[model samples]
Target: MSQPLTAVSLSGVTKDFGRVRAVRGVDLELQQGEVVAFLGPNGAGKTTTIDMILGLSKPTSGEVRVLGIEPRAAIARGLVAAVMQTGGLLKDLTVRETVEYTRSLFVDTKPTDEVLATAGITEIADRKVAKCSGGEQQRLRFAMALLSDPALLLLDEPTTGMDVEGRRAFWQSIRQDAKKGRTVLFATHYLEEADQYADRIVLVSHGTIVADGTGSQIKSLASGRVVRVTWENADTEAITRLGGVDDVEVRGDQVYIHAKDSDTVAKYLLTQTSARDLEITAKGLEDAFLSLTGTTDSTDSTHSTEGAQS
Candidate 1:
């Protein structure tokens, strides 16, 4: 039998928990070998939608298909696997023992050494799970997920507790795996990870998808650039009143202005004001995320988890 061209599909899918409608009319698709990022603010239904795709919960309406079949059916066939933020580990077991134990549950599985190497945890194979760092444990989970050699991998906040170097190393492994034609859908609060790693980014807001495209394309939707200047006596109200200016922020002697016409703002700052050290730059993924999601504080506690929806 031939594999399906579409790795995952969701059409008008909605999930309701009593009075709460978590996911609302979501329509999405992922092609084989595509690395896609699923991003949204807290309580935006990202994790709820992921649960439906994993067959842990059924949708209240519409459909979700994995590898052109029901999600459970795809999982049963060993075509799908997930690496969640935490859990599913035995603290007493060594890293190698954990993978070996998981492999026993599958009829056919990747070799323990191969999976450990692929997840970048071969050196820690003999280390007990409880002794592993947060990043090392995540790698162990990745190795276990690969035991089935799944074609589609779903990761939810995979780097939640890792340090800078750990996050970098983890993503390096992910990039290498992507080259082998695996489809990956990851939900994360780390905007830079989505910007740097994902081939495409899907933004969800208030239970609906607000933007879907490549990182550059998504950034373009925010519709403005930012101009920064240094002036001891900065007039924030005056900058906000400037033509084409969307927002103004003042901190100490620095003023940051978001404007549709950055050139106009830059010229005004240089000529009309005592502003110095002027700079203009395009809006980045984080800018787009805030603009599209109506979120003022990107680092809100809501980012810790998807709240009630998760």
Candidate 2:
């Protein structure tokens, strides 16, 4: 089967700040009704790319389109709704009042009760925004965004302050929105969140897309099974004798071998007289992300202005 036409497309997009190139030659496509998670370390230009797509920042070079027209044009039609990291609703207004106010801006809005329920904030709908907890406030923000019934949802860390259950509830609501053919582009620090909710994952590093595909597809890039073995001696000679193991590291009394096949490699290790205890493990998404991004926590760079409301 053929892939569907994309809802948003970015081609050869580049953005710069003075002498620094924030985002460099970035390209991305988000399909209609598809949920894609945008991931990157702090300075990876994930926010810059999203800003370009949202038309908050103009790209120094390249093309960006959302819902067929330009992103700004889409926003003008009320087809796109964005829930930023901060400040989308009135701080003084009650949760219900905020929803009602945002609803007034859109011709077609979801019912306040329904939106509150969808965001798992029904109980606090009457509470003042200033009095709400961080998670409650996040839910209220989402409720306000969904009030417009947008064709595309851009959520920047939607569940940042949510607990486990709240995050699950928020994702359930997102899935329901996707079921109705809405496109969702979310940025999250939680790997498991992307693995569970996103149909495709996009990894960004140094302002460019380094990896993009399904979770399992990206994980496949590592292409190695993990073998755990307990050796009598943490010696190089014993480690070298294990065939088919590519990356070998010894920790205390145990050794980890990364190989093509864990079972086969485990059997080989068992053949050694010193290999009394051995275990095999599979590569996980975290390992894949670290391998692909290779980003240490030092290069954090992103600045958001609380200047406008989308």
Best by TM-score: 1
Clashes by residue pair, model 1 = none
lDDT of 2: 0.78
Per-candidate TM equals 0.78, 0.78
Question: What TM-score would you give candidate 1 relative to the actual structure?
Answer: 0.78
Clashing pairs counted in every model: 0, 0
lDDT per residue for candidate 1 within 91-125, as digits (tens), equals 99999999999888887897889988878889999
Off by over 4 Å in 1: 1-4, 120-127, 163-165, 226-259, 262-282, 297-306
Question: In model 2, which regions exceed 4 Å deviation?
Answer: 1-5, 110-126, 226-281, 297-310
Could you tell me which residue pairs clash in candidate 2?
Answer: none
